[model samples]
Target: MKFGKIIAAGVLAASLAMPAASFAADKPVVGLVMKSLANEFFKNMLEGAKAHEAKRGDYKLKAVGMQSETDIETQINAVESFITEKVNAIVIAPADSRALVPPLKRAMEAGITVVNFDVALDEKAKKEAGVELAFVGPDNRAGAKMAGEALAKKLGEGGKVVIIEGNPGADNAAQRKLGFEDAIKDGKLKLLDSRTAHWETEEANSVFANMLTAHPDIQGVMAANDSMAVGVVKAIEAAGKTGKIEVIGFDNIPAVQPLLKEKKMLATVDQFGQQMAANAIDKALGVLAVGAPLKGWVKTDIKLVTSDDVK
Candidate 1:
């Protein structure tokens, strides 16, 4: 009887020695898909998420991104892989807003919670796909408006400027153009024309060079993203007009800080990539672990950054 008692006591001690959260293994597995691994913004996002996971150690996180934004089929395959893996939740920054809907809906239908960040899926497409997902990112339209407002102020009333937009098909790019248009609506600044650079520095450079040839008297340029802004800066320098025209961009990418401080670029909007990504991970865990219902959208904050704010 005493031997049996000792054996039972040992079992109890072993159970007590294990972490209460040992059952955490049963916690939901989360999958994160980014637009591209090559983008610095997404790199920061990955780092922030990893830091959050280290601190919380709550659920399993499987984060991966596509090779490039244009690789739509690959992104879809990534989602399918997650579906096969049976992840409980997924947070995605879609490459092409409309193209990603079908696979995303499939994930949702498979009982996986979906949280979208950055670029938004097309509303009509989402409805047609028959799935509703939560969005966690900055208010893209409002953020762009803030940047455009600053650019307009720098250019002053009656200034002539041009816009360098991202991929035309992306919701963020279209929304940013609207925000820029809204800011210039005071009839003070005239938009010579807007062109899509498709989010490439080289394309932005070539496009801006051509725009400069067509509109040499333009006073300023508003680029939808820092990558294109880099190209704009190069085109300006190439045209021997550096510092002669005002340049502003969105996304305070670290690479653009030197130019900002040099006063080559006026300002950029910081949507706080790190915080947005970490928050999205927590939101996913909330829905998966605690049975928390995901809501429509959780818009994060945006701040303006100049060269002085680089550090």
Candidate 2:
């Protein structure tokens, strides 16, 4: 009778273990890999993702990324690690759009869903690899157009201006430059000089300093992002021409708030980093929980923040 009871107990334990195994299988795991957490933008993105994960318990979110924006190899390793862990889905903001294709393709081959945000993947690679389930981020062109129009209005009918571009091959930087040129197409404002600052404040400051010497009559400056804008503003101040030059930037970060308050920054375009993160997580959950179709794009709206509109 004791031996019979032992056998029955073993059967009951096995039965209980089966349901727990099934429950574990039911919970979906998602991996989010960003460019890096060094920047406030990516940090906000992580927070937004976490907030969404908290609301939806069925999905498990694993967040990891490079320590610095320039560490592409580290990002690749992180993605590989996610693949080894067998995540159901992967969300990434790639550092180099082209270079990341191979690893991303490998993830897809391993049956992991991949989503691209912030930066985009190369069109050819994206099509050929059949990776990248979706892209969610701002309408960069529209954002740039709004920023350009704001700068143009500040510069009046005619003025000389300099553009501080981010990275040379960065799609967002190129789009912003194109939008700015399109906005000022009436020949009212001439682009005196344009240089790539690589999104570095020091580089932007140095570029602007050199440009000032070459074109002493520059009336306005438009930077691709706020970090570069801060550098441009510093250059203007160093040259003793802060209020004299109209400066505008993209990404209305908290650091730019005081500058706007003091009327030193004319305006900035808000990319809504937090919204991007929230949306990414929402889509990721939908795919994991409901087996929803993952092939689509979501565009977040941008807002123009000026001194007058700060409140």
Candidate 3:
């Protein structure tokens, strides 16, 4: 009887320790790739991802990004590194939507689950590449539509509004522009001109400066991102018409908050990038933990932030 008791205790101890070993071995690993670390929006996303990693003991995360938004090659290389490291999942805010497809497809084919956030993957390309990827991000078109509708409300129809866009290849930029177009189309807002600034503040400043010269009577400005929007405000100021025109921007970056608070800019769309990152991490981990299949798209919240929304 004593011998039987000893055997039972040994079996109980082995059973208890098995879970610890299993958990340690079974922890999911994810790689987070962003456009560029220089932008506050991407930095905020990284912070949210890291904070989530710290709180969740069941996963490990590593983050890497390009130094500039146009560095598609660097982004591709980063994905390759993650692939070599054999991470179970990859969550990326791609630098360029179409360019990242090949590398992302390679990862997916290598048995890694890939989740895209902040921008969308080209679905046609994904099909062509013969690999699948899951997407998580704000509805860029809807968010921009919100900003456009708010600007329309302020302008009250027939207001001449110009659009400054980001990199032409950026999926989010295109979607935001589409949203702006959709909103202004119904409102019959006169489009003075639209130009691409490649998500550069200086380029946007120069572009809007020229727009002001060509269309001095413009009543409003629509920007695909906050950086360009901030640049538009600078141009308006340079033209000595700062507070006269309604400027609406997307991505409620902190730098634009002052302009909003002072009522120089009408409103911005808060894409909630941090929340997007958190949700991406959660979904990526789910893929590795239980083979939870993330489907076509997982969109987060978006809000129209005005001067009143700032405080």
What is the alpha-carbon lDDT of model 3 when measured against the actual structure? 0.77
- Which pairs of residues collide in candidate 2? none
Tell me how far the alpha carbon of residue 158 in candidate 1 is from the true structure, in angstroms, after superposition.
Answer: 2.3
**TM-score, candidate number 3:** 0.89
The lowest-lDDT stretch of 10 consecutive residues in candidate 1 is 3-12
Identify the leading candidate in terms of lDDT: 3
Flag clash pairs in model 3.
Answer: none
Ranking by lDDT: 3, 1, 2
Tens-digit lDDT track for model 1 on 65-139? Answer: 777656678878889999899777777777788887888777766767776667878888967866555555567
Per TM-score, what order, best first?
3, 1, 2
TM-score of each: 0.87, 0.84, 0.89
Native-to-model Cα distance after best TM-score fit, residue 214 in candidate 3, in Å: 1.9
Clash counts for all predictions: 0, 0, 0
| Error at 5, model 1, angstroms | 55
Deviation in Å, model 3, residue 161 alpha carbon? 1.1
Local lDDT at 223 for model 2 = 88
Identify the superior model by lDDT, candidate 2 or candidate 3: 3
Badly placed stretches (over 4 Å) of model 3 are 1-26
Tell me each candidate's RMSD, in Å, in order. Answer: 10.9, 11.4, 10.4
